[model samples]
Target: MIGIRSVVFDVGETLLDDTREWMAWADWLGVPSHTMSALVGAVVAQGRDNADALRLIRPGLDVAAERRAREAAGRGEQISEADLYPDVRPALAELRRRGLWVGIAGNQTARAAELLRALALPVDAVATSGEWSVAKPAPEFFARLIEWAPGAPEEIVYVGDHPANDIHPAKVAGLRAVLLRRGPLGYLAAEDPAATAAADWRVDSLADLPGLLSPR
Candidate 1:
């Protein structure tokens, strides 16, 4: 197997637990879980990427919108950083220790940095659609990540939970893509054959990441 020298991670399902965020959104919108869940499934079925999903939820869900949603739902506000995936920090630290350049590519607002800080999984670079105003599944995001890292795409692996957003675009950009199986939304990818085929690798937990990415 070719050795991977760098790694990029998808923020939502890959590195962070986004269920709380979605539930919070549902509460804010006064939509029931069942209702919002259906919408989420529909959004994914349409192959709408994460950015598209966010746009579909709220045309402009900026930091202010996020706060308002939480407050309206009677849920105390918390930064995105407060909701990181379990074992993410340790996994990231291990990857860095193994001499890999680490980056994060996601469709999040500037709050991504805050979340990373909260999770304590600081990476070498971060490329976000919110910052660039472009989303993934589009080659533009991956292309920008390549430019930001200035590393050979083959040497970099991108990890995400979504088949369309992470695996497809990462592979097209010449980067290996690892699918993380976590969160309720990822259940669809687990059951879908086509989605399963898109990933270069798959792990049930982020704790498996160090072993998966370690040079063989």
Candidate 2:
């Protein structure tokens, strides 16, 4: 197996637990959790075409949908940057300790810096949708990552919970892809056999990351 040298992560579901933010949105919208769950299920049932899924969920929301959801809640409940993810600092630290270059690629707005500071994950570079004006599953974001890291594509592994956005495009971009199976979005991997097949590897927790990338 080719040894992995650099690891890039998808922020929302892969490293950050945005459940609180989602639930908060549901409460604000006066939509029940089950209703949102059903909507998400309906979207996933459409399979790997994320563009189709987004159309069904909330077309206007687009890449900034999560942030828009939080804003729509009207509770003055802004998402704290630090409360974004669980156990991220240690994981990033461990990767660095193992001598791997770390970076992040995801869809986000200007609030990305706040979110990163909140998670406290040590990332050498970041490519956000707001900055690029494009989202993942498109090669542009990953291409930006390559420019940012300037590392060999084969040595970079992209880890994310989304099949269409993260896993598929990383492979298309000539980087290895790892699916993170511990977040809300992880169910797609479980429900869709085809998605599971596309992933180079699957991890249940961020803590397992170090071992997965460690030299054999």
Candidate 3:
């Protein structure tokens, strides 16, 4: 029960819904949307990396170049404000109103920051794995997030939907972890009796977040 001072969020499926983006990627890969969807589910079920799942769809695909092509065609990889959860803005606003710094830290691609910035979400900081040179489930990434927060790890709460990447690693980094029930891995984590207990907090939606993190 460390007094919480800041909240860091995972971008995809937590704050922003990427279902359309995934579907778009499926189209770009010349695969059926259902097929891509199933692959995503399988990846989560097997505890596999998402990149591996994409490679299964299109081996030797140049992911970066593909993204650039999409952008050039006006189908940028960034999530729009329309894709964001209904609860996201209010929750973030509440946190800032309560004097808590807010940020987004996730294992997103290079354009993540640009996309998030486009949404004009109320946050103090935004960062992606590509920018940090490290991805989640890694101590170094959390270290960078802590530095970005400019807050003591004990006083920060990392909110995300991934059990392995967000909850466990943030806990190991000495930040309180809050499991948000949205995204591919969220239900998967709940199905595991042990994994469900790993988080310091759990909420069904970001709307429930403000009350949970009120200074104790």
Candidate 4:
């Protein structure tokens, strides 16, 4: 394996806690938060994509319009810093201090990049699907990270919470993958040996990351 010189991350539950965002979606869809949670869980249990689950919940919904509305609302409302996980800043600082170039690449609305900037995350670069014109699990999305980071794909590590979105795609793109277990899909991935085995490293929290990626 090539030595790692850079690291990239998925934005959602990887760096930020998306519980409130999902709950907001539940409320906007007129469903109870628990009901929405159950549906998301069921979707994962069956090894189905979350998009399929959203379709099952509300077929024919105009997602793009809804996203636009959400972004507009976000612009007016201040997103709390508490939405970020406690370990994010320290872990990122440790990685950067160790000379690893850090970046963020994820599936998010156009506003997410602005939000991250507003939140003052200490990443070197940030790219969202909205900006890149492609989303994760897509070769283009992972490919963009290579363009943004300082090293070759094999010399980079991509870390995130989702098995399919973060780990699998990064591996397919020729980068090492590390699964951070804290998102909605993380539990399902953790229980599936095939998913866990696909990653080069699996840690319960970002706090475990810096040491795992430390130079040997």
By lDDT, the best candidate is 3
Q: Which ten residues in a row have the lowest lDDT in candidate 3?
A: 207-216
TM-score of every candidate: 0.79, 0.80, 0.93, 0.90
Q: lDDT winner between 3 and 4, please give it.
A: 3
- On lDDT, the stronger of 1 and 2 is 1
Question: By how many angstroms RMSD does model 2 differ from the true structure?
Answer: 3.6
Residue 41 Cα positional deviation in candidate 2, in Å, after optimal superposition: 3.1
Stretches off by above 4 angstroms in model 2 are 48-77, 81-85
Over 2-109, each residue of candidate 3 has an lDDT whose tens digit, in order, gives 578889999888988878888989988899999999998998889997766678898887777888898899877757778989999999998898888899989987
Candidate 1 at residue 75, lDDT?
78
Worst 10 residues of 4 by lDDT: 70-79
Give the number of the best model, judged by TM-score: 3
Task: Please estimate how well model 3 matches the true structure, expressed as its whole-model Cα lDDT.
Answer: 0.85
Q: What tens digits encode model 1's per-residue C-alpha lDDT throughout 55-106?
A: 5666775745666555676774354545776587778878888788888778
Please give the TM-score that candidate 1 achieves against the real structure: 0.79
Which should have the higher TM-score, number 1 or number 2? Answer: 2
- How would you encode candidate 2's per-residue C-alpha lDDT over 106-187 as one tens digit per residue? 8766567455645556777666787778777778878877777646887888889888888888898998888888554687
Which pairs of residues collide in model 1?
81-115
lDDT of 4 by residue, 1-216 (tens): 336788898888788887787787787678889988888778877868765655777898777777667667763222468888899999988888888888888888667777777776777888889888999889988877888888888889998888878888889999999887787677668887977999999999887878778542
Please count the clashing residue pairs in each candidate, in the order shown: 1, 2, 0, 0
Question: Worst ten-residue run, lDDT, model 1?
Answer: 47-56
